[model samples]
Target: MTMKIKKILLTTDFSDYAHYALTYAVEFADKFKAEIGLLHVIEPIIAPTDFTWESYDIAELEKKSREYTQESLDKIIREKIPDKIKATPIIRYGRSFEEIIRCAKEEEFDIIIMSTHGLTGISHILFGSTAEKVVRKSPVPVLTVRDPEHKFEML
Candidate 1:
């Protein structure tokens, strides 16, 4: 059977695992003639009590996030993806899994690819695996990469 993928959503945390996933995402997109959407979701930062509404700086945070996202996007576009594949970068603020789901639904992407830290011990307890939650909750297929093994295929 022939497989055709038009759009793909890739979520990244700018980690090493995520960089590996990005490589796979780019290759898959190229092979399928798909458009890629790269998303980075910033988990909400809780401020101290002393930091009131006036002290809160949403704009600055947003600006920093956008700059970082763009830097990441530029790096990937330059080093990872080939000229044949087209991709867009997106930055959002909120829970990671929720933002991923929302972007997938709203963007109507055919595939979702991301990376997992494969965290254990205290780290796992503190920050739940976004990749795990995404795989469980995503209505569409989710391709998560941890190690650099196995060939990537669309499900």
Candidate 2:
């Protein structure tokens, strides 16, 4: 069966694993001639001090983070993707899953492609996988890249 994926949203944490997912997302987008939306979520840094606002330079940190992520995203597209692909890079601040879902809805994305952290033991229990939560909560189809050797699947 054939699927119509006109708009695809790919979320990245700017990690190597996310780069893998981005590669797959780009290949799929190119195959379908879909518009790609690249999103990077900056997880808020909660301060322990009572006067949290003063403790951290939130604006400067956020600015740096956004700039770094945008550069990385731009580099990936420039180095790996063809000139014909339509894409945009979006930087947002919030919980990863929430921001991803919000962007997907706001951008009218037909699909979401992201990489699973594949955490184990305490880390997995303490911080649940964002990819898993996104799959459960996403209104549209969510594609998660987990297995290191598995091929990308289109749903």
Candidate 3:
């Protein structure tokens, strides 16, 4: 069966693993002639003590985070992706997996492409896996790309 991919959602944590996934997302977007929406989710900061900062201070922090995230997204588009590809940077503040799923559903993305950290065993148990959670909960098809460091035989 043929699938129509007009919109592609690419999620990143600004990590090397995520950078590797971006390459695949770009290739798919090129093949399908799709518009790419690059997403970065910043976990909401919670004050440790009862004495909380003013709303203005919180707003400033969020603004800075958005600016930094946008810069990073722009750098990837300018340096890595070709100029012809239609790409937009999206910044959302919340839990990574939740925000990713919400964006994909709300925006009606055709598919989601993201990198997995490839954590396993004790580490996986302790930290859990964002990719795994996203894959399970995502409304659309999710393509989980593994880091290049985890080599596998083609056979």
Candidate 4:
């Protein structure tokens, strides 16, 4: 039996590294004749509890940030994605991995395609890989693409 994919979730962090996944996602979508849901998750800013964070206008900042992100998402679809392929712009506010999984489940996407930055050491410890977390927990299939520029060297 052949697999049938109708909808695809393409996750991006708006980075050069994340752009790599677009190629793979497009190929898959083209093969499956699927629509692409371009998703971008905005992580909430964590302010220090003791630093008088209330003085800052975080709500306004977040609103502007979301607006900016939406524009960027649309731009990507308009420029990178093919006209023949249907694409939707999706933006979520919360943890990156959590939002991705939740959106995929809620939208009933056939598969999730995203780029992995291959974080290591302290950087990895501080901000864990979102792609890795999604792969571990997502009930749906996840396809992760690594940065083409990064090469694993023998230690």
Query: Which candidate number maximizes TM-score?
Result: 4
Residues 1-155, candidate 2: write the lDDT tens digits.
98999999988776768878888888898899998888888778666666757857867877787788889879877786677998887888898889999999988899999988632347567778888789899999998887487677799
lDDT, candidates in the order shown: 0.82, 0.83, 0.87, 0.89
lDDT of 1 at 143: 89
Of 1 and 2, the candidate ranking higher by lDDT? 2
Clashing pairs in 1: none
- Tell me model 4's lDDT, rounded to 2 decimals: 0.89
Report the lDDT tens digits of candidate 3 across residue range 16-92. Answer: 88899999999999999998999989888776555555434777887898899899999988888788899998988
Clashing pairs in 3: none
lDDT (tens digit, per residue) of candidate 4 on 1-155: 98889999999888877788999999999999999999988878877887688788888889898999999999999999999999999999898889999999999999999888632347566777887899999979999888877898999
RMSD (Å) of each candidate, 1 decimal: 5.1, 4.6, 3.8, 2.2
lDDT of 1: 0.82
Q: What does candidate 3 score on TM?
A: 0.86
lDDT of 3: 0.87
Question: Which parts of model 1 are misplaced by more than 4 Å?
Answer: 51-58, 118-123, 149-155
Q: Estimate each model's TM-score.
A: 0.81, 0.83, 0.86, 0.90
Q: Higher TM-score: candidate 2 or 3?
A: 3
- From the highest TM-score down, the ranking of the candidates is 4, 3, 2, 1
